[model samples]
Target: MNRIQRVQKELERANADYLITGTTSNMYYLIGFSEEQMERPLLLFITRDDYFLLVPKLYEEQLKQFPLIVYRDGEDPYSKLNLKENSNVLIDDTTFSLFTIEILNRFKPGRIGRASRILGKLRQVKDDEELEKMEKGVKKAEQLILEFVSNIKENMTECQIERKLKSFLIEEAGNISFDPIVTSGPNSSMPHLRCSDKKVKRGEAIVIDYGIKHDGYSTDTTRVFSLGKPNDPLILEIVEIVKTANEEAEKHVREGMRAKEIDYFAREVITNKGYGDYFIHRTGHGIGIDVHEDPYISPDNDDVIEQNMVFTIEPGIYLPGKFGIRIEDEVVVKKGYGKTLNMLQKELYII
Candidate 1:
């Protein structure tokens, strides 16, 4: 179903009259527009009877393109017009600041709900268009990784690699989904390590994690490579274990499966290999307009897997003061199984 149909269905379920506020992701999902006035707060009022967009006076012309009610700041449209009371209003929790909340409460005090929580749950499952965009994103990210690894030189600092990756991604994809992670040697052991001036040495494993954005959709992926020759057999072994676990978990993923179960399937593989403790963080998380979404693949998540849901299946083992290896891939849940979006080779690369 299209986004409007999905949202109308949600309105029926909630028995809400209107949903208000201007969150970029939610607004893009509801109406096929990402206004340039995103820096200034805007409000999208969606009701069963009407659709209204409230923007700053400066964005009046842009709002006119859409066929809906437009409310500008300089004009007191609400006062001039009659707004029905007791109209169930859904507000974006993040966009509605404390001051805005007070104003909204004074004006429309009836049944107020939060759109962030509701829409978050709805966005967990990807539709055909969303999946297509994410697939493109993943392909671009994989290509960037390949290019980055091919040009890697000895004694290159972590910052140098990160800068190169960012430059390539911006030139090719327009923008990166998030900050690229580049760590070499012992620094790779930190899952969220920041890039530094530490130069990479021969026979050391370097971890590169990054994602690309296309049409507001994102795909996250990570890969580990060894410089020169393979200096640590344990690093290679861990990579293989994580890769196998990721593959095995994808096999069991289908509609109706619990998210936590998928995480356990991958975790069990690493545990059986006696490297469970080294594996930190969740197996993966839902990906879409935002890098992280709902229906996350973690021990604490109980959300069930559904058809059209897209997420990453990344498993890693980090041995502190040594090296870390992570293999990640984006997957789309289907009827019988999950389909991998990333085509990059999973075998440990020796650069």
Candidate 2:
């Protein structure tokens, strides 16, 4: 069935009278209509048997292919909904408060609920077209990494590398999924550190975590690099441990397993080596239209792994005031196994 039909089924199962959402990823997924959200109200209304887009006159022609209800400038768009009071309605979690408040004041939905309850599960198991786009995104991300590595040299500031990576992503991949992280030496201990002007030096570990956007999909991966042999032997040991953790987690990814099991597989490897406390953050997160999504591989999430669900498996160890090591790879669950999408070698590279 088509996406709208699938959601209609969900609405049926939910016993919801109607499903309403604004300009968001959820709306884009359902009807292929996406635009930067603005004050102008653009909404999608769906029911068990019918669907329509309500947009401003400015978008009337742009979205002509779909069923549309258009309002010109200066018109109160909310009045067009004509929703009945005490109706059962589901709203997108991403809907703006301006619209939501109007909904509550006007419609007084008998039961207001979040659309994520239905959209989240449907989005977790990607269709073939999404997988194709995601695979292309992964290849673009790998290319960006290779270009970054080829241009690396000693004494370059982390900000310089970050700028170059950004340019490459915009030029080659069309956009960036998130800000590229280029941390060195002690700065590497911060898993989400913003790039700084500190010049990378030999014998200090460097953590390069980045992602790019390709055809509306997101790709994320992390790799460790060093200008030369690290000054501390512990750096190499930690890298190996993190790499093994990433590997074990990927190896054990199977359909029907809890999302937390993936975290345990990686955490088990790190904790066994006596550095569990340093392994901060969840093992991984689902990556798709958004850089982060559902089916997160975290210790507290019990979502089951399902076929065609794509996510990441990253494990790390940080030594305060010293350095950090993280290895990450994106994987897609198949019939009964998980396959890594990244083509770059996980082993630490000494330049």
Candidate 3:
């Protein structure tokens, strides 16, 4: 079923009067309408029998052709919703703030529920159209990384290389999925290290984990670049271990497998090799409109890996005050295994 039909089913099952959401990813997912997040609230109030896309008057002219509700400044949006007392209302709690909640309270719905999970649950398995857009994003990102790396120099600062990343990406797409992570040398040891002016040099590990958003879908990848042969024996050994861990997980991923087991598939490899303590984060997270979404792959998640569910498998070994190595790939679960979205060579890039 399409997104709208799927959500109508959720509303029916929950006996919800309506599902009201702001225009972020969720709104787009529901109706394919894209708008900027603004100080003024833009809501899509959806009920089983009605579709009211409410927007501020400022945008009404552009969207006037479409039959939707429009409210101008100095108006309470709650009035437009035509909400009833004791009505079961579903909303996106993550995007709606307390002020918005207070406005929602004016209508006195009997119970207010969160719509994030219901939406995510329906989106876990990508449709063919989504897969196509995602793959296009993947190809663009891989090309951007490879082309950028070809010009990477030993003495260039991390921030120096970072500045040019956006221009390169915008040439082929819209907003980036996330801020590109560019860490080098000792800084690479910090898993969530922010990009800085630290200059890369020979024998230092440079970790580049980044992604781009294309056609409402996203692409994420991480590739470690060695300015030259990384001289640190420990860094060399750990990178190989992480690579092996990533590969093992990919080979074993299939539909009907528990999400946590996939985590174990990678975690066990690192643990057996004596670096389990060093592998600090969850094996991976689900990827879609948002870089991090549902069906998270971790030791605690029991959600079964489903066909068309795409996620990243990134395993990293970080040694404090030294260096780190991470190998990540985005893949789609299949009948017996998974297929990686990224096809770039995963071998260590000895620049």
Best by lDDT: 2
lDDT of 3 by residue, 166-231 (tens): 666766567788888888888988989888888889988889998999888878899898887887
Can you tell me which runs of candidate 1 are displaced by over 4 Å? Answer: 35-39, 67-89, 93-113
- Ranking of candidates on TM-score, top first: 3, 2, 1
If scored against the real structure, what TM-score would every candidate get? 0.87, 0.93, 0.94
Candidate 3 backbone clash number? 0
1-351 in candidate 1: lDDT tens per residue? 756566667887888876665656688777867653344456677766556675566667776775544555666545433456767767765563652564366567478778765688788877777778888778777777787688788898999989998898889888888889999999999999889999988888888999888888987898888777778787777778988998888788888889999999999999999989999989999889878877789988888888888888998898999988888888898876799887888887887
Model 2's alpha-carbon lDDT is 0.89
RMSD of candidate 1 to the truth, in angstroms, is 3.0
The numbered model that scores best in TM-score is 3
Which sequence of candidate numbers ranks them by lDDT, best first?
2, 3, 1
Cα-lDDT of candidate 1: 0.80
Lowest summed lDDT window (length 10), candidate 2: 76-85
The better-scoring model by TM-score among 1 and 2 is 2
Tell me how far candidate 3 lies from the true structure as C-alpha RMSD in angstroms. 1.8
What would the C-alpha RMSD of candidate 2 be, to one decimal place? 1.9
lDDT of each: 0.80, 0.89, 0.83
Q: What's the distance in Å from true for residue 280, model 3? A: 1.5
**Span of 10 residues, lowest total lDDT, candidate 1:** 74-83
